[model samples]
Target: MDFYLLLWLCPLYIVGTIVYRLFLHPLSGFPGPKLAAVTHLYEFYFNLVQDGMFIWEVERMHAQYGPVVRITPHELHIKDAHFYDEIYAPASRKREKYSGFVAHFGTPSSMVTTIQHEHHRLRRAPLNSFFSKRSVVQLEPVIRENIGKLADRLAAEIQKDEGVIRLDAAFTALTMDVITHYSYGKSYRYLDEPDFKLAWKDAVLAASANGAMLRHFPAMLAVSKSMPHWLLKKLDPQAAVLLEIQHMVRSQSVESLQRLQAKKEDNEKTNTAKTTNNDANDNNDDEQAKSIFDALNNPSMLPPEERTLDRLQDEGQILLAAGSETTAKTLAVISLHLLRSPAVLARLREELISVMPTPISTASWVELEALPYLTAIINEGLRLSYGVTTRLPRVAPTEDLQYKEWIIPRGTPVSETSYFVQMDPTIFPNPDSFDPDRWIQAAARGERLDRFIVSFTKGSRQCLGINLAYAELYLTVAHIFRRFELELFETDVDDVRLVRDRFFGAPRDGSKGVRAIVRGETLL
Candidate 1:
């Protein structure tokens, strides 16, 4: 009788607690579903069970319950185009990343996962110049080289078989090669792979499942960072390839550290022999161009904590993955749209021909960028891609967020999605259609459509690889279109459709990728 009474009491107690949370919590006043107010598991269901559908569900919540709706027991999601800038504030503001997101980024050491505003600033400072516009422009030749290799391969294949190249595979290979070479002073040559059989891309995609699990349960992230390699492989075999890549990154970082240490010892021995301390530092382009490895290893610039071997490994992984994946997807999407829309392709090629009237290889990025129609096409591509297609949560630990009359308290997670913001019809008109002319027309009207496009997000936490991504897109688009006339083959809208969110959006119905045949002669 006593055991049965306790069981009945437990059920009653749970219900009572939930009733209190739904009706009497600090955020109870906020407009949202009663179930959402009761617990965060509502979010967990959509994100974990439904496979990253929570962002869309949040949008639906916004439709039903205004802009500011309680998404979790402790968090509020605001999907307002007008307030995106305010929500994702400047780096100067106290915008700490929500703890819920730390898992997706892999490690707390990476600046992307750093929570504190000042901490992120200190961590990100060392990497600023390496990814700057000047740095990327200087690195364009290297970019063109890998892209040139891809173009050559495609051209040769077309001549041999008149085959349809998978744009996603081609783009992924091109991007992976460029970024690996850029960051580690070597290329994985994913392009060099026959049919691009690099399993690393699939491995990266699978990690999205790990990310969702980690986000829902933070305990996994801690274990992931500290757990032994043998054990992780035992649990999930796919992690072996992922871990192999990370180990490769760690080896590069360790090599840089060793080189730095050897130089220091040599400097000391010289000073002792000569009885004089000559502190000489050389910042030549050769040393400067050694890739992001040496830059992050600089002791004077980066703090000791941020420069740990483990931290360096995490940083390199994030940089390589972040730098490559999004760019590859965007380029694939752009190529797909261009192939599908012949009129758009015709107009773009005419502009390219008018500007250079020569081969694509001979034309510099500066020349390609100068073409108004080309620039408009790239902008439209960025707008449509929505590269990181999920809600990025930012919490103001010291300040309350004001969404109209509602005062969301400090430490409450406030979030927005790139999907809905870029898809907002009020701002984009026909947001679904891939129309480059909208941008060209907007430019003619002097409208700032660029402000509304937040694929890279905004303010302090913006993507560091923006310049590099831009360089890749500009160069690849120019080279491919200038060299070959691409057209869709056995591929349709469903192949590239944004079906499920895996952090990076996945295509519907298991389409291999955007497949198209390569035609025409190399423009050069």
Candidate 2:
């Protein structure tokens, strides 16, 4: 009788485990490695503790599971381009971002995080103006002006050191300045400031680090908040930084609006004077080009209902966040690659020399778009050092999503792992090698490069900053390479490590950070 009871208990335990995983687990039905379904503790261990190398583990699983693999019970990690279509397809009813990560301040839902379709639509409408082709073209001068400042600063630093200077910090500063200028319309200047604002920088870094953990473990956020205020502060330095950045951003945004209002009033007064005196016309015309505020405030430009403070601020924050790190990181990685490959560097320098002798004072969007080598180098860099990886997860708003032989249940988090897809050996031969020739060849054959290119993502939810990012990249790379020769010192290609945050990736241990040795001062 005792032996019979023991036998029944053993089967019960085994069945209980299976039942718990299948029904009780957060991500049960979605196919994945058995371990992943069992628990997310491994995922957390790797991401937070091991510095985000878990994606490689997921890739290995995909090798066994074909295109789709469940990394988590609720999450499906897909790599096929067709899955991209199914997820981002226009007709496919999907909500905004998932509620895994909450906003830092206020209940305001920005374009990137808003979960509701209608709310996202409302938020994205006015914001679209700032990112439109015409708008970006108009804002080109702002980007160029910032780039010029950075070049001048770098040139000065090089001159001081006989044309050799570390560029990691410099690039960060430059991008920060550029984003600030664009976001606040030249009101705040971190560029010329002698000392870096620790609070601001810390806030951004902290927020970024915590953002990933919060997204993965939403329940822990409340527990994290419940800790003693000082203890919490001590435990999560990044949380403070995140809050500080949001505060600074909000404060700066309010100040920017105020300045715009004041400028509009001044402009009105100037126009009134011109109308009354007729002699003031010359003075009014001589006033600097219209600010971002002027364009937005122009009554004829957008409908009256569209102009709202909340909308403008929402768009401004998105633009600032989207544009800043992406361009800077791309430049940093491209510079690193060029420094490593003398042949590539020389070829690029030759191309720049042939294109513009005096460092291209001005190039139209169309002209820049046509530069083959420039496009190749940028595309290659983007491919290698993709700023953002991790699947852009979207939930199926409908009852079911049918793809191939599987019916992905509604509300299941479905996403394409861009990093894995972009690194496919079949699509990009020798995927690890930084070769621009692949892109050039593909472009020559008229193959639609956008199909597999996940740098800017695709469909309606694609990066709105795509054009701006490209423009900034082209101008910065073209101008910098044209003027200076970037040289890597005591560094190899393998030395650069990926510093992965929740949403994006940066260089770890400042690996890409290197000395830029002027051509005349160095022997190749």
TM-score of each: 0.91, 0.80
**Which structure among the candidates has the greatest lDDT?**
1
Residue 312, model 2: Cα distance from true site in angstroms = 7.4
lDDT of 1 by residue, 1-524 (tens): 99999999999998997988888877889999988888778988998788778877887898999988888887787878889998889967778888767776555578788888888889888789988999889999999898889878777766755686877877888888888787777788888887874466676776654676767776765565477878887885544545666777789778767877786687666556663434333322124426777778777777787778999888988887788778888898888889889899878878888665865535777787888889888988888788788678888888887878988889888888888888889888878798998888988999988888888888889999998998899888987887786678888777766777878887775677788887767544
Superposed model 2: Cα runs more than 4 Å off:
1-29, 90-95, 101-108, 162-164, 193-203, 216-232, 260-318, 359-362, 495-502, 506-514, 519-524
Candidate 2 colliding pairs: 27-73, 27-74, 203-241, 206-238
The TM-score of predicted model 1 comes to 0.91
Candidate 1 accuracy as lDDT: 0.80
Point to the candidate with the largest TM-score. 1
